[model samples]
Structure formats: C-alpha cells, structure tokens
Target: MQRGFFVSGVASTMAENRLDNITHNLANVNSTGYKASRSSFKTVLADSHLAGNQKQTSSASYLSMGSQYIDTSAGSIRQTGNALDFAIVADGYFQVQQANGNIALTRAGNFSRDGEGNLITQSGFPVLDDGGSPITLPDGEVSGTNDGMIYVNNQPVVQLGLVTLINKNDIQQAAGTLITTPESNTESAVGTVVVEHGALESSNVNAVLAMTEMVATLRAYESTMKVVEQYNQLASQLNSDVGKIQG
Candidate 1:
C-alpha cells in the first residue's frame, strides 16, 4: 500500500472522531449544567521498520485517541424560580451519595425530595449534609444558605457537604457525571460548599461554536478522503503504464 494512502486514511479517521465530539455537544446544548467536551489528538511516530525514507522527511498522519477528557468548565447560573433548584456559588460540587456509597460530583442541581424526605438529585442520589450524612427534610421544604447551611421548615437541620477531589485529573467522565475514587488528602466533606436556592446552572456548551466545529470537521474528513482517492488513482495509472511498456 502507498504510504500516502495510509497517512490520509489516518487523518480522515481523526477528523471523524472530532466530528463525533462536536455532534454530541450540539445535541446536549440544551441540557442543564452540561459541560462541553473537546477532543484532543496525539501524534505517534511511525515504526522505524516502516520508515520509507531514512531522512524521515515523510511522516505518517498524526493518530488521535478518543477525547482525552471532558472539559468540566463551569456553566452559567440561571434563575429557575424553584426553591429546590440550587447552584454552587463557587468552585465546588454538590456531594451526592452514589449507588455503592461512592461520592460523585455533579453540576445538576434539579433537586427534589424522595419518599424519605431526603433532598436528592434528579437521578435520586441523596444530597449529602455537612456531617457527611444525607440531608433529609420531612416536615417541609428544605433551603440552604450561601455558607452550606440547610434548613427544614425554617428550622436548622443539617449543613450541606461539599466534597473536594485531591487529584482532579484522576476523575473520569462516567455517563456525563464526574466519577472519582477516594485519594490522599481528599477530604469527604469540607465546610466551604455553598448552595444557592431557586437557581439552576446552564450548560457550558456554546451551540454556535459546536455547530461550526462539526461542519469544519466533516469538511476536513472529506478532504482527507479526496487525498487518498487521488493518491490511489495515481498509483494505479503508474502501474498500468509500466505494464503496457513491458508488454
């Protein structure tokens, strides 16, 4: 196979991955507290044995690994006029008790009360209180202060728990939520987690930007395919000419 064909093919594949990321972002533009993900690419040198020229003037196209990580950039806070809808006032996440008792970080604050009167995320994960316990409000609606204080029926009950990740990079995007395991120096709940009532955070994805990127990536992929086709045609023509002369 011609080296150019292989290089062009790789380029086309990278563009395809980029397009997928853009498309997914556009689809989730309206999702509340959604974070836009950006795809990253890395280049790996071709094996020495596959080197066409010792001078290394020729290079294989850069290989792209699927999105390195989702950008957890903060989204804008929008007023929802609902008391249960809360937004973090600062750089923190609402501590939710996940299924297996693991802690998960999420920006989704569309909270509601369950049968047990526990404040929970839309997915039913119980919201953590200051003492690393679930915040439950039985009598009436629960409200919180900017300093992580929670009150039920106008009576102070438990404070909200705000968790911090020791190594933010260790966290991975799982089903659009940030999942992390316990790490060193990582405290379960700190006193600094603030909750804002009656507001919801908007997705950080820029619809216009994501749409533009999607189109650009598709065009780039088409161009790469064109290059591969042209290279293959030239090779075929050269082989046919040589055969005619030899005959």
Candidate 2:
C-alpha cells in the first residue's frame, strides 16, 4: 500500500514536468526559428528483502529525466521579400559573434547592417563570414545567393559562415535563438546547406499537438493527486483504529 502511494507521487512529479514542457512549447509556437522541447521519463528498479532473508526484485517507480529541445528538424520557410532576410534549406546553422567574442550558432536569418556596414542578427550579434570574421558589406543593393554568397552593388563581397555540429545534442540554447556548443564539436559545412535569401524560418512548434499534450498531462496529474489523497485517508483511519484498540 505504501509503495502504491510512492508510485503515484513520482508519477505526479513527472506529469508536472511534462505539463511545463508542453506549456513552454505552446508559448513559442509563433517564435521565429524556435524549436519545441520534449520531456523524457525512465523507470527505476530496486531490490527488496522479503521474509526468510529472501531477495525479491520489483518495479520501484518512474523518474523524470527532464526535457530535451530538438533542433534538427527544419521549420517552414516564409518569404518576407526583405533583402537581408535569409533562411537555411538544409541541416545547418548560421554563425554569429556574440558580444564577448564567442561564436554562437542560430537558425534565425533575419539580419540587418549596423552603422559600420557589418551584418548582424536581429539581436545585434555580428554575423560571421567564411573566414570566421565579421562580414562587413559595402553600401549598395544587398543580395545573397542560394550558395551563401553575399553580393553588394552586383559585386561578390563575402560568403556566409554556415556550419554543422558533429553531435547536435552537445549544443545548448543561448539567449534568444542562439545556440552554443564546444568549439571542438563544430565543422565547416561548406557545401551541405543551401541558404534561401529574402526569406525567414518559422518556429517548429505545433499548437494543436502541444495543447493536446498539456490537457492529457493535467488529467494525469489530477488522477495522481486523488491516489495520494486516498492513501492519506486510509493511513489516518488505520492509525485511529489502532489507537482505539490500545485504549
């Protein structure tokens, strides 16, 4: 009976975690270049000693291992007709130089030129070029090719620095849409990814799916609470009966 209550309590915790992840994903359904997260659970087992010093193996409980944000899938591409807007059509990421001079990766291609003619992301992070340097463009009609070549005044200036990670799970989310990974995990993706100029990528979250998941998780949590409450009532009644007998 005690083990049943323990199982329900652990289940309730996992349900709460799942609900949180679903809510977060729903909130970012409209964010640019956003990826949805998923909560994972695992079952734990332990050995119990029964009568006569006999060992029995039984299912212990469930454990919540937290969530993982998936970034491999590409979001839907939308054309904004903006000269600086860009989108990746393949498995790759745009390189950006953070304020502290650390390199970060992102899928957001909504870019603009700063006062110094340096290309930057929406958050003002300088966009890197093929040579791992900030791209400084000349003032003119700006255009980017599918091959990531930046052209100004119909003249080729520099190529965009696009890369792919050996293991995407090693990457962690930074501020906004930026992602950071160890320098050793990155490699130059020269010809693997195709860039679409004059376009942007929408968030990969699905609202209907997230909402359904949230509802289910809430229901499961409520059920667990009921189990815990019933266990408490039974425990109280047994204690009262034992006291009356002793008296």
Question: Which candidate should be chosen as best, given lDDT against the real structure?
Answer: 2
Q: Tell me the tens digit of each residue's lDDT in model 1 across 1-247.
A: 5566777877887887788778877887877777676777777766324356455444444575645566667788888878678887656776778888877777778889888778888778888875667887777766767776767778888766776666655666655544455546356545566667788888888988887877888888888988988998999999999999999
> In model 1, which runs have C-alpha deviations exceeding 4 angstroms?
46-63, 181-185, 235-247
TM-score of each: 0.82, 0.89
Tens-digit lDDT track for model 2 on 1-247?
8677777778888887788878877887887787667766665764455789676756454564555656568889999999999899868889999999999999899999999999999899999997899999989999889989989988999999999889978877788788899989989886778999999999888788788888888988999999999999999999999999999
Q: lDDT score, residue 209, model 1?
A: 80
Residue 83 lDDT in candidate 2: 90
